[model samples]
Structures are given as C-alpha cells and as structure tokens.
Target: MAEDPGTALVDQAVGYALLAMAGLRADALARATPCRGWDLGTLCAHLAESLVILRETVTGTPAVRACRPGRDPVAACRTEALRLARAWPAGGDGARPLAAVAATEVAVHGWDIARSLGACRPMPDGLAERLLRAAPALVGGGRAGLFAPPVAWPPDAPPGERLLALLGRRPG
Candidate 1:
C-alpha cells in the first residue's frame, strides 16, 4: 500500500532524528536536555512512547506494548518510529493529523536530543512551519503541562526557530 504523504514526511523527520540519536553515548543518556526536567533518556522515552500512542490512535488499534528502557535508546526510537510510519491506516479521519503531530514531536524532539548533545543540526524548516500553523489547534493554544507558554520571537526569525518558540522552546 502507498504511504500517506504526511506519514512519509514524518518518516523522513524520524530518520533524521535517528541519525542524530545514533551518536549518543550511554553516559550521555543521563545528561540534561532543554525539556525542563527531562534528561536525554527521559526525552527519548517520551518520544518513543508518544510515537506508539499516536500510531495506535491513527491505526485504530489497542496499544499492546509499553515503552521501556532499552539497551539502545536510539535503536528503540528507530524501531518505534518505523512502526508508526508504517502503521498509519489506509484511511481514517485522524490519520493525517496524527501523522502531522507525530512528525512535529519527532522533529522537535530531534532538536531536543541534539541540544542535549550540543549538536548544532537544524530542524527541518518545512515540517516545523507546517506544525507551527497546525499547533494552536493541535495543542489547544499551548495548554498547561503539554507545552510551556509560547516564548516571544522576532517576526523575522527563522521559521524553524519561530516554530520552536511557538511550541515553547527557546531557540538558540
């Protein structure tokens, strides 16, 4: 079956994230990240679990597995991301939206992972821009606990950075 374009886009973003995560060392898993109280391992765990839940939502399936710490966090994420990208239903009202959110999560968390490692790789601008436009509704105007209050960014800031700000991440 042909993949949905949104799903494919999400897959691409996940691929980039997996690449970034592949370089992380075991010791680095305990390092703090931009996600407030979350360390690298915590962020990774969230990312993986979120993907699985979103996948189940999109696929109309009961979640059968729980995310747990793995020997290789990167590999665990890669596996879950692949499952999410592949498991999107052939047709569903929520599939595209779920795919988009999954894409945003992976893309934004990709930045979080990179930030924790002090890596300077850029988030995909197109995906960030798309998510930024959809985010207000998706996240209920940055609801409490889901996201921090939106940080102010200059109008002329880079699209990806601006998107990050909209999602409550301070872009450096």
Candidate 2:
C-alpha cells in the first residue's frame, strides 16, 4: 500500500524531537552550526518557529497574518507538532501535510547543528533515496548555501558521505 501523507508529519515530528533532544543542551546553545553562521540555538529557534508555521498551515488555521511578537519559538514548535499529531486529520488527495519539507529540514538541519558543534552523528543512508525520490528539485534548489559548502567525496569516499555532499552539506 502507498504511504499515507500523515507519515510525513510523523517523520518530521520524529526528526524534530530527535534534534531537539540531542542538540538543545546548554552547551549546544553556545555552539555554532554549519549553516554558514547560525548558532545551534538560533537554528533551533528558527526551526521551532517554522514548525509552528507548518502546523498551522496543515491544521487549516488562517494564515498567521503576522508572527505573534516575542513568543518562545521552541515551546511553540513543540506545541504545534504535538497538536498536529494529536488532532491528526485524514488526508485528502494533494494534501501537503508537512511531510517532505519537515523531513528535509530536520534531516539537513540536524546535521548542520551537529557539524557546527564539532560533534559527529550519522546521517542515514536511506535519506538519499528519500530525498531523491521525494524531490529531485531539492538538489541545486532552494536559496543556495542553505548549509555549508557541499562536500566533495572523492571516489574513495564513503557512499553515504558522498551522497550528503551532493546535497550541499559537508558530512558530519
């Protein structure tokens, strides 16, 4: 059977929670990430805020109109992600439902925070397949330099590492 769209949101929740848990310690806040110049704290903040935005979108809340001023981004993201999951709705055809985008961000951004902090965490080999299958356009796409300079895997480089390089990130 084909995968349900809610699977994507679930994936995002998994990724989001994983990153938050693994990388949001006090030391992590002080650490910089590989996203050019984003500190881990700022990166998390951005992502958390983004999560709320995405949750609101999928939940059929009217466009936020404007971001509410001075809210805790992390709290907001966690709340929204939880809310989305608890209230999980049935998917109709063509529902965007926070699947690919969240997964991509969490996957990519998770590594970014790790590399910046000089900590090593494995990127799953399967991510390449998912990324390619879900959105080839993600390659050479986006605003550019979304992460640090892409890695160049020499022929001898591990396949997983090379694949990440192709996606515009240095392997962690």
Candidate 3:
C-alpha cells in the first residue's frame, strides 16, 4: 500500500513528542509549562488525552481506559502514541483532516514539553512548514479558552517559530 502523507505526518509528530519527553523525571512534573497555568504533569496528561482522542478518531475504538489517574503521564502518552501511529495508517478516507489536526496538536505540544524542560528544541523544519500552512484553518478564531491570542511574529521568522506564534506561543 502507498504510504499516506497524513499518517507520515502523525508519525513524525509523535516521534518529536517522544523526544521531548526524554529524560523527564517525576521530580520535574511540577515545573511550569508554556501552556499557561499548566504544570509539566498536567501538560503530559493533556498530551496523553490528546493522543487517546487521536487514536479513537482513527480507530473508532475507545482507548481512554489506559488513562487512569496516577498512571505515569509519560507512559500513558507513549502507549497512546504507539496506538495512534498503528491506527493512523489504516484510518480510511475520512482521517486526513483528523491527521492534520493531530499532527499539529502533538507537534506544538511537543514543543511545549521541551520548553517546560528548559530545552530549546525546534520542530523539524519541514513539519513546521507544513503545519504552519494548515494552522490558520485549524485554529482560526473561537480560540478564547483553548488558546491565548496569537502572538505577533515577523513574516521572515523560521517556520517553527511562526507556527508557534500563530498558535499563541512566544517562540524564543
């Protein structure tokens, strides 16, 4: 079967998120993250939930049973990420748009995880460029509670920085 671009994008996003999660320790779970008011643990939990949603969207199967409270957030995210990757390639025709949204969510939140760890990891330039093009439609308007107002960014900024700014993150 021909490789699906959407599946590839989701794979890349999950891989990047996993890299950001490397070396995370329980002691640092309380660290503040770029997502205002959310600590690292909370952000990891949200990431795990997002992964489950993405997997369910593609697989049409409930995966939320893995998200019990007190489960290690990173482990939960890893499990769901693996499941999502496995399901995405077989996600049928309706999964493309969902793939784009999932890719964006995972990649941006991956950046957030890195930032929380005081790292400056940049999203892959190609992935950032693709997501930047798709972001306006994905996050345009009605974003009051879900996202902060868009941060102003120079037109000439790198794609990763521009994408982050569009999603209301201040890219350093």
Ranking by TM-score: 3, 1, 2
Candidate 1 error regions (>4 Å): 1-3, 63-66, 69-72, 90-93
TM-scores, each model vs. reference: 0.87, 0.68, 0.94
Where in model 2 is the C-alpha error above 4 Å?
A: 1-13, 16-20, 62-90, 96-98, 139-142, 145-149, 154-163
Error of 3 at 116 (Å): 0.6
| Angstrom error at residue 57, model 2 | 2.1
lDDT of 3 at 95: 90
- Model 1 lDDT, full chain set: 0.77
Question: Could you say which candidate leads in lDDT?
Answer: 3
Clashes of 2: 0
lDDT of 3 at 48: 85
Location of the lowest summed lDDT over 10 successive residues in candidate 1: 64-73
Which structure is stronger by lDDT: 2 or 3?
A: 3
lDDT of 1 by residue, 1-172 (tens): 7766776667777876776676677688899988999998878778877887887777778774445534466656677877876776655556777767787888888888988898887776776677778777777854788887789999788778887888788987
State the RMSD for candidate 1. 2.3
> Any runs in candidate 3 off by more than 4 Å, and if so which?
none
lDDT of 2 by residue, 141-166 (tens): 56464544555667566544664676
Write out the backbone clash pairs for model 3.
none
